[model samples]
Every structure is written in C-alpha cells, then in structure tokens.
Target: MAATSHPINLEVDNETLAGTLLAPQQRMPGVLFVHGWGGSQARDMQRGRHIAGLGCVCLTFDMRGHEKTLQYRQSVTREQNLQDILAAYDRLIQHPATDPERIAVIGTSYGGYLAAILTALRPVRWLAMRVPALYWDEQWDTPKQQLERARLMEYRNSRVAPETNRALSACAAFSGDVLIVESEHDEHVPHATIMSYRAAFQRSHSMTHRIIDGADHSLSSERCQQAYTDILTSWVSEMVIGDRIGHLN
Candidate 1:
C-alpha cells in the first residue's frame, strides 16, 4: 500500500533570516588618522592600511596646513585644523561600511592635541595619541606658526589641569579606552605634557601608556617609527577584538 505523502513546511521567515544574516555584515568599525603638524596623510597611509586589514574602514586626510595646503602652514589656526578633523571624522562615519558607534581616532603630536579636543565633540570609542602637544587656550584663533615659541615651550613644561585646558577637559570627560604613547626624549612635547594628559583621563574605561625608549617627538629613526607602528597596531587589534567579542556576548 502506498503511504500518504505529507508536505513539509520548508518556507522560512525571509525577513527574520535576512535580519540575522545581514546585521553583522552591515557595518564595520571606522578608524580616522590625523597626522601631526607639518605631516600629511601620506605619513599615515601605511598604518591606516594595516588597521583596515583588521576589518575596519580607515580614513586618513591631510589637515588644512599640510600637503596641498602647505602655503597655509604659517597661517592656519588651531581652530581650522580642528575643523579639518571634525570634517574628516564626519566623512569617515558616513561611509557605507562604517559603524558610526565604533569609531577610533589616532593622532600624533599636534594632531593628537586636536584629536583630544575632538572627543568632546564626537562619539569616539577608542583614542590613541602619540606625544600629544599641549597648547595655551588663549590663542584659539592665532595662526599656529605665529604662536610664541618661547612661551609655548614654557607652557608645555608646566603642569596643566583638565579645567584649564580644552584638550584635558575633553580627556576628563571621555569614558572610552585611551592609548597615550610618549617618546622618551621628546623635546617638543615635554614629559609634563604627557603626565598632564595621563592625569586628565579620569573617566576612561581603560588607559594604556607606552614610552618608546630613546625616541624623539617625531620618531625620526626608522626603529622608533617601527616601534610606534607595532605598539599602535597591537593596541588597536586588541581593542577591535574586544569590541567584537563584547558584541557577541
């Protein structure tokens, strides 16, 4: 005798399956690299490419005073460079693959200074600063090249508090992870400035401080540059992995 055939309900909720499968693929972390004064996006391209390999959307742009805008180096104000950073950040997050909530900013020296202040204005998940320079709040609109070299040197040597400095104030309120890299022999950004930044991160979820031995502010030596790249890439890798794991949990 032939058995009666029963039809199996093979249909699935297409919407539910699509949501499950597409959610994770929809967005990725975004990393924005801001180069130091006198430096251009070319300086950060390699590092940005490395970070991008770790499943992130990376962006690197020349600030107003650098690269094609070299003529403005002597006239560009910190405010203008800050605006550059803000614009780059906005463009980075707007990318189709970028997850606006998972943003990382890496900056060196003057760029670091701007990145710190940017935290106060944007949503940043990770911040990495190398020899972040400190500046007086009094010269907000003055051309960077015109700032008094002597007084700027003196101010960098002195201890500063979060309340008195804009960057420090931003650091004080930041609740994300932070990476502060110092050069052992950095004359441009004194030890006092690094300490001030370190102290200002009162609310950071985690802070990692590193010192590249016998290095200058610029990391001019090849070894020093390689060391910085290693440190930064490792820290970023760890942070990205942790972020992914947290999402899974």
Candidate 2:
C-alpha cells in the first residue's frame, strides 16, 4: 500500500519532474502512468493500485502543472510537453528494477496523446490509451457537428489555460498498439476524433477500441472505472502472452 517517491531532473533540459513509485510484493511488469487535465500521478490512484496488485511496478508522476512542476516556467508548446514525457520515460527506464524492454505507459486523454507521440518518437513495446486525444480526424459530413465543436472550443477557450493547449498539441507522434476507449456519453471528445485517429493509422492492426456502456467522459462511474481496469489488465495480459496482432478501428 505504501508508495516510493522521487524527483527526477530533466537530463535533456534541467527542470525536475516529480514521480511516485508503486510496486507489488512480487515483481512482474513495469507500468508508467501519465494523467490527463487537472490530473496528477495520483489521479488514477485506484488504477495504479490495481497495476501494483498485478505484480507490476507502477510509476506515477505529476505533469508540469500538478506538483513541483510549478517551480518551472509556464510552457505552451508541444515540444515542451514531449520533453516532459521523454524525461519521465527516461526516469522510469533508468531504474534498476525496470527491465526497460518490458516497460509500458498508460495514458488517459491528454496523457494518452503524449504516450502516443512518445511511442512514435521513442522505443515503446506496448501502449494503452484511454480515449486518447491524438486524433487524426478528417471526415465531416454534418455541419451540426462543426457548430457543436465550435461551441465546445469556445467553452475550452474560456476554461483551459493556454499551456494545456500547447501540451495537447504536442501529443501527435504516437504510432503503436493504441488502445482507444470511449465512454458512451463522453462530454469531451466526439467519436469523430477516434475515427480520425483510425483513418490516420489506415486500419492499423495495433489498435483496440472499446466503448464502456453507460459511462461518461470522466469514467467516474464505478462501472466505468471497473471496465477501464478490466480492459487495461486484459491488454497487459495479451502483452505478457506476446499477442501483438491487435484489432484495427
């Protein structure tokens, strides 16, 4: 139940990234978790515990806004956010307990985008993306969808700060077994975004898309969270069994 904590100074830059280490009584796999907007490494505490329970080492860390990241300057660029991801990945792989080859990261929304981009840029053996925002959407048939999206953009403009936008923009280099999930009633990203991602990949066999019944954007419902955990664990199971031929779209 106890978790280890550490501070990692960026090797590429010089900033520091705060992280927490969670490990089970047994050694199995190493999972690095990246959270979404207003989320810290602790945002998905339950999921982290679950990963630990599965005998995997879990690493959770705060992004630029969550913890010690405040000490650094405010940044609003994809390059900067990718820097953070690279730093976090480097921190995890350098650990003596981590196999490097067996390590993976679970990202939700914003973090999902980062994980995708990072996988494309780095050497990731596996990836689990939860409703990732790294969409490659190109289809539009209805004008209503655009109008609705414009309204949503206005809302996002009023709420989220500019730095968050920069980070979101930076999450597009991912190319792996991207597991994209959608809550049936998600308030944030529409299904078209997922379609865009699918289109970008061109029916790539490295994607698994699922919809949690009766769930919303946050996956706050107990049933939704349970579904999320189950799907993620199953993905891990497949990875352990070396089943890489994933479903497309």
lDDT of each: 0.83, 0.63
* Per-residue lDDT over 1-249 for candidate 1, one digit per residue giving the tens place of the 0 to 100 score: 111111111112111100000112246888888889887776677777677777777777777756556777888899888877787787777667789999999999999999999999999999999999999899899999999989988999999989999999999999999999999999899999999999999999999999999999899999999999999999999999999999999
Candidate 1 clash pair list: none
lDDT of 2 by residue, 1-249 (tens): 344444444444565666777665543457888888556776566677766665566777776655666543234344565677788787777666666666777888767767766765667766777776542222222221233455653443243322234323333334445577777777776666555544455423476788898887788877788888898888777765453233221
What RMSD does each model have against the real structure? 12.9, 8.2
TM-score per candidate, chains pooled: 0.89, 0.71
TM-score of 2: 0.71
Angstrom error of the Cα, residue 9, model 1: value is 53
When summed lDDT is taken over every stretch of 10 residues in candidate 1, the lowest stretch is: 14-23
Candidate 2 Cα errors over 4 Å, as ranges = 1-14, 24-28, 68-76, 135-176, 202-205, 243-249
The all-Cα superposition gives candidate 2 an RMSD in Å to the true structure of 8.2
Q: Candidate 1, which segments miss by more than 4 Å at Cα?
A: 1-26
lDDT for residue 42 in candidate 1, whole number 0-100: 68
User: In model 2, which range of ten residues has the least summed lDDT?
Assistant: 136-145
